[model samples]
Target: MTIEHAVPADQAADLVRQLYRAFLARDPGDGEVAVHIANMQHDGAMAAVSDIIYSQEALSVRAHAEPARPSLPEGMLAISRADIAEVVAYALEAARHDAPSAYEVELRVDDVGRGTPLAVVLRDALQPPQLPQESVEDDASINRTIEIMYRMALGRMPGPADLENWRGAAGNGGRLSNVVFGIGESAEAKLIRGAFDVVPGIKVQLAFEIVLGRGAAAAEVDHFRRMVDKQGSDISPLVWQLFADEARRRLLPPQHANDPHLAYIFGSRGAVTLADWRTGKKAVAKTAIKHDVLGFESVVRLRPAEDCVVSILTSLYRGGAFIRSFLENMTSQTIFRTHCELIIIDANSPENERAVIEEFCRDFPNIVYKRMDARVGIYEAWNIAAEMAKGRYLTNANVDDIRRNDSFEIQAALLDTLDFVDVAYQDVLYCFEPRLPFEEIAKRDFRSDLPVVSRYNLMEFNSPHNAPMWRAALHRDVGPFNQSLQSAADFEFWLRCRAAGKIFYKVNEAHAAYFVNPDGMSTRPDTRGAVEAYAVSRELYRKIVSPMLVISDEEFLARVDEIDAAPLREGRRYDIVQSALLALGTRREGVVA
Candidate 1:
């Protein structure tokens, strides 16, 4: 293999330029080409895509002469950074094994003639130890590098897509500026950290461009950041003081008042899916979809991929006897902040509802109150709360759902830790009454093991308790409540979301407790509740039950007999062991056979 070496000049330059152009042109979802550029050592003898090669077979373009001028496939242009690393690795090995060591690697492009000046010195570079991208997870350093490449390919620094760049953006919030972001593989991560790396000079230029560009309204800026959570958050009384101070100083820029994206809605018959997303809002299927424009029946979709995970839209409507306890718990957990807006969506007791909500909001400036004329079911109120939500995620605060301190805070923290986990439940108990001593609660009711039941078990077993903070964007994926069902709307939603992705994630630590209130809408099942629960449970079992839950008809029916014979009172509570034993019967074959 007599190899001929060539100069690292215009040909190398052209090759590099063409590669860059090709990469930017196709623009793979992860901004793969851009990353390769950033990772390559510029000062050295050779330039290469950072981590494009892993093996010869994986390469889209085989560099070895044995393959004789195989043109790199256009697909390679959109390759992921991880795959690219592998491809490049193979190329390096091939370069080393060549008998001549250094070779004149001529460029051959179908679009551009072969010899149009693209060649480079095949440097004898020793490859560095490679690491799997997944192993690193959301490594800060790597993400920042990714941000830079994404911006670089888009031809900007501190890219306009950066939420902060829209400081004073007006006229529908620089929608044009933001969409430039692609639904790339790591889309969620990109949205989480809005900071992008612009070639240093470009970053400075863009910053100045933003400051001088048409200033955005203060409300718009807050709304925009609130949408993506790019700037991070500080939900202290100080944040409110900042708001009030800014308002007073007239430093508050005008917010685009007419933008109608007030709420995001995702409907579900069973559970909330996006409530505990790590990055942007998680997706809930069946009840939501991705549309070119805003959706109907649900809240309008935003950067739904990352920005709109619905949690607590507004902390305004908190009501009932649980108010003091709720606030005290919220306080003890340190989540009761000035930015919260608690609204009372319970329409059952209108007098107590309005009065309690109003008093609570008034007592705490952070809270507010509102109501629907006709009593909307749990899902609908969820929809309403989503629409009314002002923060990152809108949590479902059932009239009877109890909150242990850190319910919101812990959900937030756990969500941040686990990317795959969207809906989370702590080691909390559920039943008509939580007032019973903790020791009296059943282990199963306590959710000791947060199992990922097959779609069927979720509908019947109830994995994610009704009370959870949700990312607003799941509205675009799942949906608000399924008004069609009286009791199982959340189950359907949770099941559907699990179908799309992972389901319930057990936090294993109790931050809140849920007391089943007989008065709770889901519990006040009329005949409709029975029919709806059965129908939904059937569907969930059919669609989502796993191997463990699946049993032959004979065995399954036998188990059902055990449950039916167990004389379990459907909706009752007890602190007395005698009642439990009596109701459950002697701990013998009677309950099972």
Candidate 2:
């Protein structure tokens, strides 16, 4: 076929600009456009196109395109000058080849001396007589194959275990390409592909996924895209810091945990050993570590420790969606720093709660983060956090729930002053969305009504508030919350406390906010699961209180029915409960009302 030649300078410039954008993901500078235009006029369009595409810049861009090495801080290069030169030279040589050649070109550290030019080293390495006919599975070839797979799939170098595992797989008749595909197809590796996302929000979400094992919240996505637009900051450092934080938390798997390229990430971030981490001694190194590793620039500064007074226990499961709001509620509290400590027990949550939690932990000193290796029931997580509580008073904090800014202060003050009250339960403001401020939500709809929850009202239903502050000694008195119950554990515990003569006082104000989420355990579309869980809890409660009860099981349940049928006292309303019932009824009728 005959080729048409470019004639006009404008056409040539347009072609060059398109090539720059297509190959380099950027517009060509004025000077670059002029040079390429001149080249095209003199050498023709095809030659110009070849030169632009085969240029060192284009080659480097393509070589590092997928899973781009996360940006480094302070313009620090991920590799040494010599290593970078070698890589560029290798890429240049590989791209220059128009067709397959008999000679194989490769560069090894042992082939070049210090200060030797990369061109000279490659020239020597490419010599057919000097090149060794190494088998594809040889040590050098396998190492190279492993490195290529890791760089492509994980955006980092393979660790010792990674190398060993891949080598074993290759030796066991596994093809090197298959190993590459295997690594590339893994869930972890899939997250690393965020570098290629054109949408900033998708990129941010992918970064969160890789670093935190969960997608980014909507607010986080918006915040990061703004950073890219206003500040012109690269998201790589954010992703890198996330990785560093994950490593600091020891949340990474063994392969990544032991990666030598990522070793500096842990070293700089004040990472502690497993034993120290378990004992709540994270962030031992307070100062920022300035040393640059392959993927990280500098370590994040961590907040100093705070004195514990009120232990806020949060059990996280599928709570990734609520992390931002939950942390805001806790940190915004007036006594958050002075009197409250948040102990988060993540029961192997399926979402990326750890990343969000650790990010907040850097600024909030009272956060205690712990991860469970396997999924556990909600009550089990609460029990775990309760035992880990260090404050004088402890309160159960659900990940999806929020309270007023002075909620902690109010609850703590009640417990601190009222020596007669062993447990203080406050009225709750119920809302559909916890993201909105409770005060704002109350203007449109509100629910705050809990009659004195004595042993009498307790038989009808668990009237004790969901988020209650009680003396830490009460845990010893009533023992930990019943781990056996799901939706009704708190109820059984309240019954236990009442039977043990523990006084429960109801605070006048609605300080706590309950988010009636449709997907929540108690508020899901199906009520059968919660009802069955309550059934189990009711049986257990009856057994625990039977010895001290004056009524039989039938009479107790009958009294509960009576309490349900009783009219509300003056100025008392269960707006939250009524709303829940309305939603439940609507769902049963196949309507969203």
Q: Give TM per candidate.
A: 0.36, 0.40
Query: For each predicted model, how many residue pairs clash, with residues at least 3 apart or on different chains?
Result: 81, 0
After superposing all C-alphas onto the true structure, candidate 1 shows an RMSD in angstroms of 26.8
Residue 376 of model 2 has an lDDT of 91
Residue 345 in candidate 1, Cα distance off native in Å: 2.1
Per-residue lDDT over 1-593 for candidate 1, one digit per residue giving the tens place of the 0 to 100 score: 00112323433333344343322222233354344344442321122532233223324333333322222322113322222222233344543543211111111121122222122211212223256452322234333433443443332344435533333332233332233333122455455334542222222222222432222222222222221121121111113323333443355454422211111111123321122221112232223212121224423222323332333532223345655545444434334553345644554544454554455566566554555566555566666766776666566665444555445655665555565666766555443343432233332233334455453345435566546655556777876667677566776677667766655666555444555444444433232544465455444433333321222223433554553342432111112223455545655557587
**Native-referenced Cα lDDT, model 1:** 0.40
Candidate 2 wrongly placed segments (more than 4 Å):
1-306, 527-593
Candidate achieving the largest TM-score: 2
Clashing pairs in 2: none
Residue 325's lDDT within candidate 1 is 49
Model 2: residue 260 alpha-carbon error in angstroms: 49
Clashes of 2: 0
**Candidate 1: segments with Cα more than 4 A from true spot:** 1-310, 313-324, 327-333, 338-340, 346-348, 430-449, 453-456, 522-528, 537-593
lDDT of each: 0.40, 0.58
